[model samples]
Target: MKNDAKTRDELIGEISRLSHLIEDRLVPDNGMTDDQLRSELGLLRDLAEQLSESETAKVLEKPAPSGRVESYQRIFANSPISFSENDMSKLQTFFTGIRHSGISDFRWYFEHHPEAVAKCAILVKRIYVNQATLQLYGAGGIEDFTDGLMSIFHEESYRVFREELIALAEGATSFEKETVVFTLQGERKDIYLKIMVVPGCEETLSRVLVFVVDITDRKDAESMLEEMRKMLIRTSSKSIDGNNSKREG
Candidate 1:
């Protein structure tokens, strides 16, 4: 009877062990709820605690690693936004004395509307005005970077691009509508901008989020489409005029 009881315990333990092995092989992602996994992990902890002294030493003595920070550094170095030689110093100063940062989080760049900044006819690097802007460019903080964006961008826009930057810098300009020209640059007709000034967030430091999309082929197609539309409209109008003259005759 005692032998049978030991055999039953062994079977249950093996079943639990197999389940843990299955979970270990499973990739860690948010697709599934953590509740079940947490409960299973707790069970495993309890089993570990219940293990004999010799087994406990084997489990406890195994050392955990020190690779998480190094792994994150490697990922940062390999990112698409290459920090050039001239850019590194300002960036380093910006990162200096800061402990917490979302720099490793790739989603921030996409969300910050960087494509709009990248497409500006006259690029405005914060370093051009306030030397401090170098550090704040891609940093998660918004205040200093967004401050006086129009005032800062106006001169460069005018100097490099056009007079539109002057109005855009002054409070008189409204950028809410989508501009076709804003998206097209060079022989490539792929410039498009969706500019919106967020309400209650229009302070000098607050950013008027501009979303830019490149559709050069689409823009060229649109130009052709506009011409076709005009031709169709003119042809239709002429037909109506001709019919009116025939009716009068």
Candidate 2:
């Protein structure tokens, strides 16, 4: 049982590392198209899943961990909403540096240095993501999801993140906002995003939970209502104009 666990861990770790390597090799001049990368990474994900399923059976035959841990794992894995665990240590360090640099007005600094906000975003590292997140982002696997992570964020999303950064800088531990993101297939989605820094992990900013709720349908409905309201206004204005002309004649 012990050897089985070790072998499984090693295999998973090696596969994850290789996936990162492939991601790093992605450059404009690399001559590899997005489709090719997705195909290759999809194969890696299939192999990893097969190995994991085989090893998990053996691991389960042995004594499992505490009931609490098992329960948390179950809930996290099967959660309906998109949930992602992120390591923000690097971003935390960057925040620390910003403070040390004596930037009292973070808003001004960020506004003036918009690129810095973009840089801060790239520093966040994904630790884990649930299946819902994979489906939400139209990702075949975690590797493809993480590799194309930044591609999902657009200018509007960055505006929301800028608010998040300001909140974090002002010592807030949680934030929520309505933003937009794109799937791997380039479909725009309106999302309600919430970010919470796990209680004990606040100092290091190592573990953060992000929840994303798809709100596109609601937004679309609201937009339709607004358009109907405008049409009604136009019809009323035309009727009023015809009545006034008849009265004048």
Candidate 3:
């Protein structure tokens, strides 16, 4: 079990490192050493081979899923509201660095170091998303969703979200807000979102779970209702004033 856990950790780390490499490639870079790239690639190849020979066999021999597991699977696969899970360790590290630098306000820090904020955006890793999330964003699959993740988020919403994440790292349990997002097809959407930090075994935040509900129609309805209410009030006030004026005459 100890060896299995260690191997799993190595695999996760390598996968995350590879993701960072891909993100780095999106921008101009000094370039990585050929030896370094080859070494990491070799390690991944070996891990994949080991998993296919041993872990795959074990999984194949495992017992069938129980009713509870099936129920959870069904809900995750079929839920109407969109949900996503993000690995937050990279984000936590960024916050830690800022805090140690004597930066108290994230907004000030971001404003002073816009380039750092832009780089930090790449650190956000979307580990999983449900089917509803795919549908909501018009994403064909996880790959499609992640390819344009940064573009999908409104700039202001991204800043707001980063602030909320910093609050979570500082001991807040959950955060919620109504923010704007864009679909893969570039349609703007109003979303009400709730984010909760999932604690690790050591009680630190391991992951962030985001629950998103599209509220565009609801917002439009509320705006129309407010306008109608104001109009009615104005008309009623006018009638009351006319009655008072007639009585005075």
| Candidate number of the best TM-score | 2
lDDT of 3 by residue, 96-124 (tens): 88889888777667667666655655667
Whole-structure CA lDDT of model 2: 0.67
Q: Which of 2 and 3 is the better model by TM-score?
A: 2
Q: How far is each candidate from the true structure, as Cα RMSD in Å? A: 25.5, 18.9, 23.0
lDDT values for all models: 0.33, 0.67, 0.61
**Stretches of candidate 2 above 4 Å error?**
1-73, 147-149, 245-249
Q: Write the per-residue lDDT of candidate 1 for residues 1-249, one digit (tens) a residue.
A: 245335434544544444343334432352433344344334333332333233322322331132232232233233321121111122223222121443533233323634433334323233211222222233333343433233223322323222223233333223322233321111222332333233333233132323233334433433533554465556668779889999999
* Tens digit per residue, CA lDDT, model 2, 1-249: 345445534544544443344445333264644455344334333433433464333332342332333333455587556777788888788888988998878888887888888888878887778898888889887677444247688889889888898888777778888999998899999997877776666778787767776767546634633554465556668779889999999
Native-to-model Cα distance after best TM-score fit, residue 96 in candidate 1, in Å: 19
Task: Provide TM-scores for the models.
Answer: 0.25, 0.68, 0.59
- Which candidate comes out best when scored by lDDT? 2
Model 1 gets an lDDT of 0.33
Q: List the residue pairs that clash in candidate 2.
A: none
